[model samples]
Target chain A: MVNKENKFNDIVTDNGKRIRRICSYYSPNHEDRKDMYQDILVNIWKSLDSFRGDASINTWIYRIAVNTSLGFTGKAFKQMQMIVDVDTENLSLLFDEGTKEKLEQEAQLNQLQIELNQMSVIDKSLMSLMLEGLSMREIADVIGITEPNVKVKIHRIKEQLKSKLSGGKHE
Target chain B: MNNSKISQDTNGMGSFIDKLKREDNNLQKIFKILKITYIVLLIIYIPIFYFEIEKGGLFQVVKVVFIALGFSTFLFVFAYAQKKIKKISYAEPTLILLKKTEKRYRPFHLLDLASIPPILFLAIGLGLSEKTFLATKEFFSSDLNLSTYLVEARQFLFSGEHWFKMLAKTVNEFPMIIVFMVTGMLIFIFVISFVAGYLLWVSKYKPIRDNALELIKEIEN
Candidate 1:
């Protein structure tokens, strides 16, 4: 039991930030993101006993996280549509004396997250997996879709996001 | 070299793990409620089934049989879901677990279809049973003078009396009218029950089936 606990802790410590980022992309509010994060953790813990050595630990975690997020969105469709009130306290925690470069990067990420929240649930899942640097084949495996389908979807989602991001500018 | 990156990662991990541990209580509470609700519903069905059988007849028996079958199907599906829920280890692959969950629920769609048979049997059976009871009562009625009337009509018709032939024809037509009325009533009952069953199925089970199918399709893809 202790060994199992240690293993779980190690996995969480290693990938927790990536999981949180993925959760943030799907969830619009601080509370929902936290809830989704907890859900993903519980799912991972529940699934830990059956983890064969077939897939890399990272691949396995991503699959659980993505699937859990999709399920969460499906269950809370109305909540997903509700406008998110930015939690200023949590936002402030990310800054350590707020350098200009750091602020600019944060702004860009926030803009991307806003646009991501507007996309369909499937598109969001695909985009987040792409952003996480998963290979097309890995994305296809995690999503249970063909590799070609993942490639097409990624291309289209990128174009869609680009248009949405650029459409807001005067130029 | 990148102390800020390490700190940020640590902070994110610490906060998330803390939140997850705290929410474990809520998850347990929800699971408990679900289990209790399922058990309560199953208990309620027992007395209901008993009462249905206590109202005994051929039609009642048939209705009870079908109801039993429907309930058995529900029990089987519920048990399967419970078992799957139990087997969900923290180590299972997400895709595999999701697929199993989908399969566990797929059988419940058949509950809507299972309901139709009992309704149809009950409706037709009731109609037939009612007609038999009424026919038996009429046959045993002390006021029924049908036999004497039939004999007199036959004799008069054989004596070449044209008016008595009409009486004999009218006597024969009485049974046809009863048959027609019984047939019409049976059709009415069947139609009403079928429509009721269909509406119930649509209202209750259609959404569940659609949701299950959506999840299963996602997994299959």
Candidate 2:
């Protein structure tokens, strides 16, 4: 039991923010996000005993996180729309000082966020994972799709994003 | 590495996990009950086969078939559920997990159908055992050896007088079979309606399942 609790701690400490971020895209309401967060933790805890150390722990937690978020539409879970909050903390972390350049890039990111919200849930989820810096291969593994398929779908999505964000210009 | 620190940092996640487990949905409880039924039926049939095998005629056949059905049914459910849980690791790939999630919330589970034949076999087995026992009361009354019981059981089975008596006994108790069958049918209907009504409407998992399918389609396409 101590081992189990220790493992749970390691998992929550390591991946709690990642899990919460993914859940935020699904649940707009704060209470529902907490509920979604709890559900993911419960799943991770239940699945803790099954961890055999084959894959990286993050990837395992990630799959569970994504799987739980995708199915987080129970009666208790309000069908709250996805609300993408700009990561101001990360933005500050990225740009130490508030400069003109930071503001410009942040505006572009805002536009990108709007485009993302216009996307289908699947597309948005893929985009979110991509922004989370998962490689195409990792994304495919997490999603149970082929590497080539991930590349194609992500490429198509990028093409659409560039065309729309660039005022219909590709380059 | 400090578990106590994690509990403090995460606001007592240990208790939260316990809370979630306690508050799990009723559908989960139902599945757990069904799993227990597997062990219960397997344990039940062992003693049943032991007690009736000495009858050595139709009684033996009925008991054997019913017990075999029970054993195989339990084995199939256990192996199948374990395979599903073991094969699809949340760490592996999302598509396998997605398909699994879709099936988990599937309005109509195919696994439930596996119980039908065993149940029907049991009902028929009970009826046949009843007929055999009614005909060969004299066989059970004596503590005869197997060969002697088998010879007498065969003789009584072929005798026209016992056949008539058996038919009369069946007619006299036919209403019990009707009641059993009616109860079974009612249970089946109740389960079906509950799945469609509760899981579909209340839990609203169908849309979630449909969304998973949509994602699968996007990825595969």
DockQ leader: 2
Model 1 agreement with the true structure over A1-171: per-residue lDDT tens digits: 446555667777788888888876665578788778777777776677678868788878888887777668756542453121233223322223452234356565566557656666566667667766788888877776678977887776666655655565422
The digit string of per-residue lDDT tens for model 2 on A1-171 reads 667777787778878888878777776677777877887887787677688877677678778877776666533223335455455233322222553244467676676556666666677667667766787888887777778988898888877876766668433
The total of clashing pairs for model 1 equals: 11
DockQ of 1: 0.16
Kindly report which residue pairs in candidate 2 clash with one another.
Answer: A142-B94, A143-B94, A143-B95, A144-B94, A144-B95
Model 1 residue B102 CA deviation (Å) reads 5.5
What C-alpha lDDT values do all the predictions have?
0.59, 0.65
Which portions of model 1 miss their true places by more than 4 Å? A1-3, A78-114, A168-171, B1-82, B86-221
Interface RMSD of 2: 3.0
- Model 1 per-residue lDDT at A105: 65
TM-score of each: 0.48, 0.66
Give the C-alpha lDDT of model 2.
Answer: 0.65
User: Model 1, residue A110: displacement in angstroms?
Assistant: 7.0
Q: Is the docking of candidate 1 incorrect, acceptable, medium or high quality?
A: incorrect
